[model samples]
Target: MNVAQVRRTSGESIHFDVVENFSPFELGTESFSFSAPVHVQLQVINTNKAVLVSGTIETELKVICGRCLEPFDYPLNLPYQDEWAFPAQATEELLESALLLEKDEVDISQRIFEQLVLALPMKFVCSEECQGLCLTCGANLNQTKCSCKEEVIDPRFAALAKWQAND
Candidate 1:
């Protein structure tokens, strides 16, 4: 999770394969949860004044469907790349654009967590053809059909329905 050795060398590259368990508490999200450990394959390359980190993260997440409110397994394989540049004896403006490295190490856990959060979709569904639920009977339409009348509408939308009928 921390690139300690890369900071010691001027131009060194290191490869790492790590498996770590991440709890839902760490992610701070109630929409999804992880039942197994996540695998990360990373490569850290140290340049003269920068450290380049690149990797792929793989995991399976249990997420709730937004439409049907059902739980389903979602698989993820995301690639991430970033650079942390050390301060050089250059102009102050140039140093402001680069990320300052911590004392002889660069922690990548926060970055990986942020990437996973951003990679998640705003809306989750079990399948593309999911019929969701019936509003009147509160039944899963994908599993069975409901006998409730489909023409029922709120009174607030009665004017719109009349206009739609005229069109």
Candidate 2:
């Protein structure tokens, strides 16, 4: 558990397998199941002159539609090829390829969670062209139809429309 936190600064390398909880990504939504743990396999490597990391992050989680608020399962496979900069850079890379960093412990959960957040869609819809829900009566536009007429303007913007009417 805590080992992952030290991987970034031990002057050592890390190879770990751990479980994570259902993050906020799996909250009150529709089709997705925000359950299960995240599986991470990583290594910190240092060669002739520099430090490089290589690994694969695997996780199974649910993606929810930002529009319709539906949920769906998504599997992630992110391969990493990155450099860790401590102060300026991991200087130990010149000594051994498999070097442990001795900087302060870098939180592994924060690293992994940040990656997951970046992986999420800005607007996650179950489908590419989700119709979303009707704003009038809260009807799901994809599954049902509503008789209410769609209005383009917000009542708050009524003053802004005076110019349009005058034109």
Choose the strongest candidate by TM-score.
1
Error of 1 at 78 (Å): 1.4
CA lDDT for candidate 2: 0.60
For candidate 1, lDDT tens digit of each residue in 1-167?
Answer: 56778877888989989898876743455645785678889898888778777889998888888888889888889997877776563346645655667666556677777888899888888999998988888889888888874666888799888999999
| Per-candidate local distance difference test | 0.78, 0.60
Best by lDDT: 1
lDDT of 2 by residue, 12-73 (tens): 55565656674554423533344567777777644323345667767776766677876766
Alpha-carbon shift of residue 50 in model 2 (angstroms)? 4.5
Off by over 4 Å in 2: 1-15, 22-34, 48-51, 61-63, 84-100, 103-107, 147-167
